[model samples]
Target chain A: MLSKSAARAFFLSGTLLFGAVFIWLTVDTFQRIPAQTNAGDLNESVVRGKHIWEENNCMGCHTLLGEGAYYAPELTRVYDRRGPAFIAAMLKDPEAVYPGQRRMVKYDFNEEQISDMIAFFEWIGRMDLNGFPPEPTIGMAAAAIAIPGGERPQVFTQICTACHSLGGVGGTIGPALDGVGDRFDRGYLMRWITDPQAVKPGTQMPKLELTEEQRNEVVIFLSKQREAGL
Target chain B: MKYQSQKVAYWFFATCMLLLSLQLIMAFAHSGFDVLHPWIPFNVARASHNNLLVMWLLAGFMGAAYFIIPDECERPLYWPRLAYVQLIALVVVGVTAIIGFHFGWWEGRKFLEIPRPLDYLVVVDVLLFVANIGMTIWKAPKMTTTSIVLFFGLLMAALLYLPGMIPTDHQTHDAFWRWWVVHLWVEGVWELIMGAILAYLLIRLTGVDREIVEKWLYVIVGFTFLSGILGTGHHYYFIGTPSYWLWIGGIFSALEPLAFLGMAIYGVALAKKGGRNHPNRMALFWTVGCCIMSFVGAGLLGFAHTLPQVNLFTHGTLVTAMHGHMAFWGAYAMLVLAIMTYALPLLTGRKLFDTPSASYAFWSTNIGMVCMTVAFGVAGVAQVYLERRAGMEFLDVQRELKVHFIGLILAASLFTSGIIAFIYNFIRYGLPVGEVEESVSAGAAAAAPAE
Candidate 1:
């Protein structure tokens, strides 16, 4: 029984009302975005990094803030998950980082560009995205058991764990490091960790660039990973 | 054909077929098919695939408008030569953007990946199109709701493209404004175009009274904006926007399906009510199919994840892809195909509507798309469990999902076959050399009720 004029009135009024509300919400959102997203921390490097991101069409593969193509990993929390050094190393040579995995087009960025990208991601990771990239509720319980070795080294956690599992955790790309001490001694561990391909040609692992102190720290930590007990 | 200028729509449709085939080829390459990976790369293939889709759909819409406006206005198109020029410019701009994407000359945003310079050219080309269509409607002896609604949709779509071009250093702001173009176009103004086109088809194919159909058109589009305007909040929920959008987006987007449901019912009921069936039964099938599938794909599947709770986990996964492929196919792609089915015979003066290939095109494409959605859905649900819930590494999860991509490729191949059949039929129709039939003009006069 609805007449044409009544339907037209409903359309006009509903659109006007909702349109007004949407505009008002947008205005309020802009006002609050500065604090929520830490707008002041958007330095020159971060801005340039955003340009690089757009220039390369990075969103064509990877996602940020839960938008973009689903071909690659979501990168909103990549800054927190993978530290700056690992991010830099990966950007320098993508295939070397995760060889024989899904391919990443190597952009061949210089150090400054890599650092700029890291800075941009650091800024993004600090934003209050209303708790996005949610913590895995079911998997944390299994990964929470204490390791037999002493506290893991910072360098090992940042770089080594990306490919090698320490105990029951880390990536499965390389072998688990649960009993690595039983398999290789401290000197051998140092040599292999520093230059994987030199020791064993055609290995999947790349030669990870590590500082002298960091290399010593990781080797010591791996040496303590005995199967019997620490 | 009633108007000599309507012949121009055939060229537009022809371009659509070509672009669509190119889009599918790029899709296979982007899906890690390996053969084109060395040449195309994932990003280039993705950019080409998505941009080609948008380009072809825009062409189809333009073609549909050109063909329908003249018939509805009871007059020839204004500046028909300009339509040809506009099409050429659009194709040139589209080709440049796709090639530039390969060479890393792009803006890098999703959907709005066209480079900045080409963006300006696109704006100019669209404005020419709007002006040409606007003048035709303006000079008509009598105006109808269908033509006016279609014209308004096109004009608003052109104006909305500006928001995406707004300069922003902050990623959050960039995303915020990009949705203004993407979301608003698909869920908002594009529905207006869909509604008008459906109204035009129902009136012609069903022999329904224009008053009843246009009356329901207002109600359906009324429901569209009432829900869709606020439904923009759904995109804001996770994009660093204010938290209040959680409820605003959730409540409104839940209502989005009602508009689509209304369309489906309207199409079916009108077809049954109007006993006088036009000879173009294939067009009617497509029109009705678009309505029902839009409800299932855009309405139901979209609702499956629009909620804040489910979306918290499924935010950037293949689940969104599942919803997206079907929604675009049902809503926009099928709408264009429906209009093409209706207009092609009239444009070419060939009654090839009820051929076996026509029916095959309809069934195979629908079944293939459904299979594709299922493959994506199974992969997506598994991904949500392994990656989001189980906290697995990204690559480990992807390796597990590789088999699903194989399934997707198989489904896509079937879909492509349907498209090939459709294009084969299109080519078989030859060209638009139809003369104006006096009897068809009388039917057109009857179809257009006095305002």
Candidate 2:
């Protein structure tokens, strides 16, 4: 049985320890993001967009910076990958983003608000995260498919094999694109190869420069791996 | 018919508890070993532990209540024949459930997963028990003794079970009610059963005033029920629920276990004040130990996690396991053992079998549990340090501390060993309960050599 005094001391120490940790974590969460709203710098377009944002309470549907309800998509880094003009057109008529697909209702906002919405998205894209999630590197294979009698394999093993591998010895930190050519035709592959995430929305996969020759060689090499597997 | 079968029903129940224990041991030990899997295999040890314990406790309660209830009501058995049927159904379900849990066939609900079909068997069995008790109590009105505590308990057991069986599509609501089944019953309702039995047993064995013990029992039940319902608040602290649950959980949960702690201290104090000369020494050991343990383990250690802040660290850790081991053992295990100590000798016509073994078994179980509590606490504290301070990955911490957790397994082994010894001694002396036979002079000469 614990003496009353001993029990009291135990509780006191526990309370102290708990309070200290609680305060530290709470303060840390608070300090992680600055709370100062950038409302002061808003132009006519941005102000109009802000009104739209408030009227609809966009957070009710979408997540912004891991806050708000998770009913809809995250819009934080969407602007960097998309065009400003495309974004404005989507706001004016959202069905343009993906034809015949459900999207945000086209609120009656002027062209200025649509531009401000683009500005807001651009601002969201600029906020830096210190490499918490490492950047994904893809689609810029130094090798390409040969039209016939090609040596694409040698080129691929030298460059593309570094970040991605199939079934064995190589760095496996990236997605295995060993047979991706089989999944798409040449036109689809070209669009995806140009800037990877534009074709696949919200993909962390980045795009880099690849000569037309190298891209075809890599596509041909990936196609060969699938044929051999089958 | 029922009168004749009640004793037999108890025998069947004892067999079931022992068998379930074996099954649990098999699953746990097989998983422990490096090679071949046990009779039932998979990642269902958690389910096995909980389900087997629940079944065994139910069986023990059935057996204990059978003996004590009739005596309290001052009547013959009410449909004793039904008891045997209940036992058979219960054993079938218990065995099947244990096997299912052993084989990785369980959905991972903490307190309420027994696979859908087999759970029906348990419900039927408990329903029978409640009907039997209720009928018996009604026929023999004003039969409020220590036995009557179980009437409310067995009823709640069924009532609490209903929410768990409902399969809701919304996972959040499903999880919410899961806590209602696990936390609310353990915290609120089962204590009535425990209180009734403990007070009755205490009064019976201590030769203490019945009024005093009953008074305490009433208070204990009152405290337990009142605090227990809100005790579910603690679990709501995290669980991906809205933030409003914070205040609802924090205040009420803090109050939940304090009553148990008070009961523990008071029970121990009462035992001390009563002094010695207990008839069933083993029964006394279980009763007293349970009183103390139910408080410290279920009450105090649980309090550490009821807070949202601490639960994030200790939620899935060995700390949770530690409290579970002690609280279940103290609240349910000890209480059942106390009842067994009484009923075993009554059926078998043995007295001194329990007396000599009490001290040794008491020491063994207590040492093992205390060691487990310490080991888990240390491990939990260490885990907290690694996660909160070192900023190590969760998997990394688990990998680093894999060896230290061996202490808990070791403590558990020790506790099992004690039960083995206690059971052996009990069987040797506890069986064949009746008046001792006197020997003739000629046979006495031969008996001297055997001695």
Candidate 3:
């Protein structure tokens, strides 16, 4: 049988050790919080949006800060993928944007409430997470739109590269143009590039304004992309 | 039922059973009915389910202490009327909090969902309980290890609840204090309570010496405090805490299984040494079964994800659900059931241990819970692979796991049946009566110090 004094000593020492470690860890947690959280996270709009999120139990469907329900997408980096306008619109009417799937229920958020939600998303985007969701570093340069140390490219980086990819480089908001020559000749390419809305009334790509020389240069560049199939 | 005042325990346990059934109903609403989405949201249902669980378990522990304390102290309860008042207040607070959850009057913290105003009521309720138990022990002729340990555990549990109430807007800071209540209660102080109850059961069931059993209790308490207090670090690994927590959490939580191993060994060894002397064999079965299953569920399964490397993949997944269901069932659920099984016949003066339903309840509940744990494990691993590992969409992964939930529902059905049987048996035994004349001699014989 164990001695009474031995058991008492063990209990006392164990309690002390446990208390010491817990205090140490708790202090460390407090020290790291201010650095990791974003400055604008505590702003009025962001704070109001946080209350709205909690009141609606959004975390029941979506994950925030790696916690809560996993039924919906992680809302951590949503501000980067779709801008504030898109987020606000989606909150107003989810089915209009995300058709064919009935996942996110439509919340009747007014304009100001929608803006607050966007503000919350924007604030969360700025936290110092040390890269929790690793971003894609490759294929991010504007080389396809305007190649460095050469003649001025026909393609405008602000217009074409913002939505489309060319020669395996650029954005993916629109279709890739790696083999556009196979799909269209120079004549069709010129008309399509000049007035995209006339070709497809509701297409997302905007028509680019170009001079005669710029138009010809863009067509010539597009014609050379057929080498992939050859 | 050595003391007439101990009958107050019956009401507390009855409330436990009532709350448990409600918790199960809410679980069904969550898993089975997709149509109830708008009216009863998932968060409302989940918060109610978890809060009810905490309420009932707290009720169970309170009941067990009331029953065990009077006998261990060799005295009647200090204030019998106070016990009844405390029980009514506890039930009132619990019902109000649960009802408030549906209307969104909740703190939104996991497990500690009761709103700020109701939290004060809970504090008052617990203080009344602690004082009642304290007075009972103080008036006793002599103090025993079993009584002192139980009192300390209950006091610590009350103290730990305060950390969850700390006001904070920072998410990381909130999570830090929340784990102090959650982790410390389960892994730290509750183990002391479980150990004391286990020792009491073993001493009574085995006809073992009090000194030997209490000695084993000391070892279990030591092991629990050594590992479990530091084991709170495991929760800090991913909650935006300092990087040093990863090392501290991983190391300490890895050692947590040792305490559970000690409890399991203590139970099994005591049973083997004592042989089958007690007529209530089902109580012994539940006592020993609780220890072994606790070791497997809380000890081994918890260790699986306690390491930082594994937790990164499995942190908030259904893997946690798997471990949670089993650990709570094996440790606290079975501990309460053991006490009930031991006390029921004595309280009502009915010897109904040899019934077929009693045997079925033991086998079916244990087997069904094990199957449910496996189902959750399979679904969780699949979810981790599809979503976290393969970078699939969250909704798509949830759709894939819908099939596994079918298995969970089936296993839960079986588990529910066993619980029904146990409750039916409890009802048939009727209300608590005064102690039988023969039990007075038997109680003395059991309490006598061994040579």
Best by TM-score: 1
Give the Cα-based TM-score of candidate 2 against the true structure: 0.63
Q: Model 1: which docking level applies? A: medium
Candidate 2 lDDT by residue in tens digits, A153-183: 5445544443355433233435666566567
Determine the TM-score of chain B of model 3. Answer: 0.98
Off by over 4 Å in 1: B448-451
- Candidate 3 docking: what grade? incorrect
Q: What are the per-residue Cα lDDT tens digits for candidate 2 across B215-316? A: 566656655655556556566544334444456567767777867876787677767766446556677778888888888778887787777656544544
The interface RMSD values of the models, given in order, are: 1.0, 16.3, 5.0
Q: Against the true structure, whose lDDT is highest?
A: 1
**Model 3, A75-172: lDDT tens per residue?**
77677655664576568766544433323656788888888888887777676553344432333333334432234253433234434656444444
Please give the lDDT score at residue A114 for candidate 1. 93
- In candidate 1, what are the lDDT values of residues A1-230, reduced to their tens digit? 99988988998899999999999999999999998999999999999999999889889888899898887888998887878878888899888999888788888798899989999999999999888989997777776767766787878777776777765566789988888888899989988988888899999888877889989998888888887874
> Which run of 10 residues does model 1 chain B get worst, by summed lDDT?
B442-451
Which candidate, 1 or 3, has the higher DockQ? 1
Which of candidates 1 and 3 is the stronger one according to TM-score? 1
Candidate 2 positional error at A136, Å:
24
For model 3, residues B1-451, the per-residue Cα lDDT tens digits are 7778888888888998899899989888887335676778777888888899999999999999998999889788998999999999999999999999898788777778798899989988998899999999999997899999999999999999999998866666777888889999999999989999998888888877888788778877887888888888888765556677778889989999998999999899989988547888899999999999999999999998788878777776788888999999999999999998888877777889868899888999999999999999999899777656654445556767888999999999999999999888888889877664456436634644673
User: Which candidate has the highest DockQ of all?
Assistant: 1
